[model samples]
Target: MKSRISRLASVMFIGAVLAGCSTFGNTFYTASYTSVSDAGYVIPAIPTEKIPPQYRRQIVNYATNEAPGTIIVDTKSKFLYFIMPGGKAMRYGIGVGREGFEWSGTARIAMKREWPTWTPPAAMIRRQPELAKYRNGMSPGLKNPLGARALYLFNKGGDTGYRIHGTPEWWSIGKAMSSGCIRMMNHDIIDLYERAEQGAKVIVQQ
Candidate 1:
């Protein structure tokens, strides 16, 4: 198994070299959280260990011409791929806007906040009266909708009022379940928030 990881690491390194004209494909590597000792090509990240089983599948072949800082959100597949050097990428499972909340096209990471306070919009409040109490501002914490981090979205000249943020709900992955913002599992979001930079270009493809 160790030999396999080393081999994969080498292939990943090579992929970085032939990046411009690269081909990509994916394979499943799912195992329960408690089992990893026998896996042949595991990436050994914390998410693979703690994330729920259903959220572990990653898309390995999508190619992007976007630079290192670009974020491509595939709403239909519920996957978010972060471009890496050498024509490789680190993919994360995501929870996107529910039916009416879906959005697409290009945007940029306008601002980022750790433990962002959430304030429900007037529409949400009217739709769900229980949220009326948070019209002012909801403290950032485990209970808050934004979870641990937030990547605010903006177009060329202004905020879209939409964002890519974290959520405590891991099971929501692959489900259209946010108020338009792209949501990632808390564990997954923190990993992304740390690697992603402010002003990164984001493309939401439906």
Candidate 2:
């Protein structure tokens, strides 16, 4: 009995040490995705200038029930909540679906990609045929629709094509401006990318 207890304690101590060392290492950080002059980002400096000054109040409190791994999107409230443990949350401003394309449901993150290629959906192409020209693939650069990262949502085996991606149109941050995809400022999207995992749960509330 004494030998067994000592062996068990030794294993438990090793596991605890490994977990503590993991916490000491940084898991993720923002990449310097651009050079000095080529980048076109200007959103963070003037939040009021990019988005409506009225939404400032909504931006501050940023409450949520989402745990450290859950994503809760309140489309009506125009806020995306990344739930943190201990009753705290990291909230972000989002632009939801446009007039005729709003949707709500639960989905799992099927995959994640950094600086993913942009491929506009056929419906978007139908609405604006001008987009047909880029059907092949848009390389990762400033003008690409999926700016710094993309979190693809899935229900069952189907692709919703409703990505949470970065956008050049930061002025529409708090508006119903996209055909269906949720848009976030590049920096904010980058921030979100760091926290999201491949199989994270997402709840989109209408």
Candidate 3:
């Protein structure tokens, strides 16, 4: 009778531990990618399971001399780290510029817009003539390339013409396939937009 009672207690403890781990995993993904409504638009829930674990948004220990609130983009590794107090960072998977389109520099967030209009640069229109139809500007919506928010970057020269912005193509996260802009998953961008402030420093590294 004593042996049976000890075994039963051990089994119950193991079951409880397993249950806690399962609950944590579910809560982590569900809370991060839940659907949200903003500015009269319904932002759909992302299927985060399709994304690699490393690309998903998470807090991590980071070592950097840069002050808290700075944004650092690691193009090669395809990660964006927003520095936080206490030597930690909120990291998000990012989509970076491809090959020749890549750029690196220090800039500051000069402006921010929710559901921003996208106007193709004259050079971009020349390369992709179909975009000429939007020479004026494209209305903001789900199909819009800029997604739900935009943080415009600028330097002393003014208007670097690159943005750290949201993308509807969540699958594009953790890849190199953009036109010089840094792209974040729409859900991730919304979170970052709330945390990052105008005039925050941005560092882009190869």
Candidate 4:
């Protein structure tokens, strides 16, 4: 009876080890979070459960000729890659323009703003007269379409009127819904805003 009990305990110990290893492996693929507070609003850390699994930010192996620190936006995959050294990138799910509104090109981030005020373009206001109330500008707040951060994109011609901005609509990620600019989750943008330089190159690929 003692020998039989010893065998059973060994088997149970092996099973527990396997279970612990499985749980540890899962953490590599899971989204990790850290508290982020910005402006007067305290932007909560994004819970993995609240975001689609595929849309969560992750480190990925990427092949690119562009140097480290370049921002490559693969609109087809609805992913934005911030290239890092050694074939790695910090990838974030993004929302791009919808249908005819899609555009592709290379530009540089000319400026960056925190808790940016949003001003609806005259053309945008024309399309939706209801937005006229915000034509002048919308104060920086949670309700603002440009959530906690904005990256102004500019090309040789000058300001392209396109922006890489944060949005409160985290669920819109990995979808095509924007007018023309790229939209990221509020938490993700805050992280990106800190890493990206004002003149970082941005490549938008269809």
Model 2 regions more than 4 Å off: 1-66
Sorting all predicted structures by lDDT, with the top scorer first, yields 3, 4, 1, 2
Candidate scoring better on lDDT of 1 and 4: 4
So what's the TM-score on candidate 1? Answer: 0.74
Tens digit of per-residue lDDT, candidate 4, span 52-131: 66677777789989999999999999999999999988888999999988999999999999999999889899889999
lDDT of 3 by residue, 17-50 (tens): 5553323353332126768899999998888679
Could you give candidate 1's per-residue lDDT for residues 1-206 as a string of tens digits? 99999999999987775552223234443222221221122222244445544355343555767898688888887888888777767688788888788789899887989888998888989999999989999997777888778999999779888878877676677788888988886656766888899889999999
Task: Assess every candidate by TM-score.
Answer: 0.74, 0.72, 0.85, 0.83
lDDT of 1: 0.74
Model 2, span 77-123: residue lDDT tens: 88887777766566677898999989999898898887789988887
Clashing pairs in 3: none
Clashing pairs for model 1 are 16-86, 98-176
Superposed Cα deviation of residue 177, candidate 3 (Å): 0.9
RMSD over all Cα atoms, model 4 = 8.7
**lDDT top scorer:** 3
Cα-based lDDT at residue 103, candidate 2: 96
How much is 32 displaced in model 4, in angstroms? 4.4
Clashes of each: 2, 2, 0, 0
Which candidate gets the maximum TM-score versus the true structure?
3
The local lDDT score (0 to 100) that residue 71 gets in candidate 1 is 89
